[model samples]
Target: MKSKYNFQVQHEDGSVFDMYQMGIWVESFHIYSPNPDRTFLEFPGKHGSYLSASYMKNRKIKISFQVETGSEYELDQLKHSIYNIFYTDQEFIITRDLSPGNILYALQNEEYDFDNITGEDADFNLTLTMADPFVYGQERIGTLADDAGYIDYNGTAETKPAFSFDVLAPITHLDIVSDDGYMRIGDPYTVEETPFEPETIILNDNMNTLTGWGPASSVDGGTVAGQMSVLNSNDFIASDYGSGSAWHGPSVKKSLSQQLQDFKVECYFRQAAYVNPKDTGRVELYLLDINNNVIAKLAMADAWKNMPKNRAEVRLGDTSNNNYMVNTSGKTDTWWNDFQGVIRLERIGTKFFAYVANITRDSASKHFRTWFTGFDDLEGKFQGKVAQVQLHLGCYGTDSAPSQAFQRIKVSKLNQPVTNQVPYIALPGDKIDINFKKSEILINGEERKDLKDFGASFFSFKKGRNNLFILPEGRVSTTVTWREAFK
Candidate 1:
């Protein structure tokens, strides 16, 4: 009995053709072995081989077919069409009916030979070299399921047996914003540290526990050793006292008129001793507005049984009262005695957000706590004006003035958002419209100097995926067309 087979050929231009439908009879098809050649390395003295490897060489397939026509014209036309397909060097894919999904990628390896050529019929023999040795399936089969979902055998199909879903729209136009501008679309702020140096010092040590304020005072303040200005309140009497000792460092004021809109106050301080368990004696650091009104305050107790060691509690308020306590159980703490504390206050739009970190001694810790306090009337009043920031220490309740020494006090303006620039990707055949000029475009990571306008085709998507990035100046609009290619 003779076997029957159907052949399908796909050309390099993505056109499919059927040989049987073209009046060509497929006589016999020959497929060579698929296994790769193995190579082994052996030593003269050793009985076993040292190394062995397999290499995949090109595979070959041959086909013998017959063509019949009634006239010379029909025979010439059929022969010419078949020659146009098999005579070229371009690659093609071949599939047989017996092998439903298995397809081979191959190219013409030998010259076509036509035997028994007559005015009516002819026999042709051709050979193909496989570009890839293995015969691949029509579609790829992945073992792992995707995050979106996978085809479940238990689920019922609506129309077809395949699963399908829609993807998000691609990014088309991107805008690039400059960081130099006062107000950008995204966050343009960069954190900078400014060392603290007090211009003035005020000390009221009524109890005479400390001499006075300044470097000569019996307090440790500066980075080096010596008596730095100390805020000592010895006003404690035999009975009780209202406010014990009070110390205020020289105010570091910045004009609200400055281009910088946000500011942070960082101070490195060490408590003289732990707070007395009996009485509520606490150390307070104040951030004052232009009118000397306390906007934010950091209150620290020597130690709390429920709280972490060396942690300070933060409160947000205006001139009226220091109400909003952001973090009740303040997570900021320091293992070492000498440590830095930071308070960041940023004016974003109409509202204000504050971030405070008490213990900054450990390098591996992320102790900074944040709060989002609604719009401040004081900030609105002093908008684009001068604001005063002062560091103060006071002793509350019956506790004596705990020696609170501050050093490396700094006031710096903080940038708005964490980052000003972002990245975007572009796929193949995508039309990317950049709202910003070419100077602001960054393709992959390198800046494209030749880009002049948004119309430039600076990127082309590869067979799979392509990445494109841009820095927007203001509001940005983008669209993308995602095209997938398969071999």
Candidate 2:
């Protein structure tokens, strides 16, 4: 505001004010850290208390200063300016020269609590409260070129960035996917969904006995149940000197209690114990219809074709077992030979979405990557069609005799299907704004969010480097802007 004063505020109408310029002298500026919003609750017979949730309350800022009053005319004019800036019901963006990297969004809290000293100098103690907890930096913007599909973001903390661009062609959906997040703008059939009270059944459970499973071995590898189920090589041989058609594999089947409407199946496994990635093992989750024919296939191939570094390959919704999903990584890092991850296959209404996440006891749900079944009438193909799913892993190299360590086989079912729709379309020549901070979508400066799509997640960029893949490269010029935030 006026040549970088000590304290300043920006109003919603773009007007700015500096503290010293308005004859205001600061005595002491106190900023208090907010108390945490969680409550400590004791269990029925437990010794220690536990916190319910983890978050902080709103922050409080107190600005104590004095305003000068000289002549009668000067006194009236100065007090009027103070009344105009403070004592407002609106929230203001406040800044300070001390915290140059941070800004505050606050509203006037409580009363002005001022005193008139001899009608010459007026002392004022103003309190402001902030709903947002973090201190923010100035907004920095960048552009993604025509051929680029990735953005490497570096920030002190995670931020909700805004995307803006003019569309060169008409597009129904602008789907952006990252390792930790997913956002689809202008998706016609699928909206934001949250499964309430999901019922998850552990099918082909290895912790118990592998009862429903059978081996239709093309090669010599067999299955064994232990701490982790092992789909090991049958005997010692070289890597793939035999026929590929009659491959080594194990398949398990389970019947659904009722006809399926929506489903989610996950296979948690380690590719091998001592070594895994180099064995070139493939774990295919087959969703079969009532007649035991395959309807959908989500496969995770570790080190395809026995290459060392070519790990983290995933295939989705393929009938022929080929055609890897573009830009899908099953494992978080490719170089690790002992990779432990979870493969998830889900159906929302007619659309099928596949997601993979690297999991560990310390860091659960790490690096989530997703791929959609971008095909036509996938709903009609498997509405009431899916009866049981088969978990199969096969075609392993006999040298390592790698037994794929199968962990948990969890099949969670939603109480109801997700049919909510949020259609956010950006036409040719239209300027698009996807505001994750405000959780708002504005096309050409107009808000178009409706009740059907309420509480939709706009998705955000996490801390450190966020690698994002925004597809169909050359059609749209992109600009992303966000402020660096301190915790």
Best by lDDT: 2
Q: What is the per-residue lDDT of model 1 for residues 93-172, given as tens digits with 9 covering 90 to 100?
A: 78787876767777887777567577778998888897666555444322212221222221111111111111123222
Point out the worst 10-residue segment of candidate 1 by lDDT: 155-164
| 170: Cα error in model 1, Å | 6.5
Best by TM-score: 2
Native-to-model Cα distance after best TM-score fit, residue 455 in candidate 1, in Å: 29
TM-score of each: 0.34, 0.46
Per-candidate local distance difference test: 0.44, 0.58
Model 2 Cα lDDT, one tens digit per residue, 280-326: 55555566667766566655555355453324433443445433443
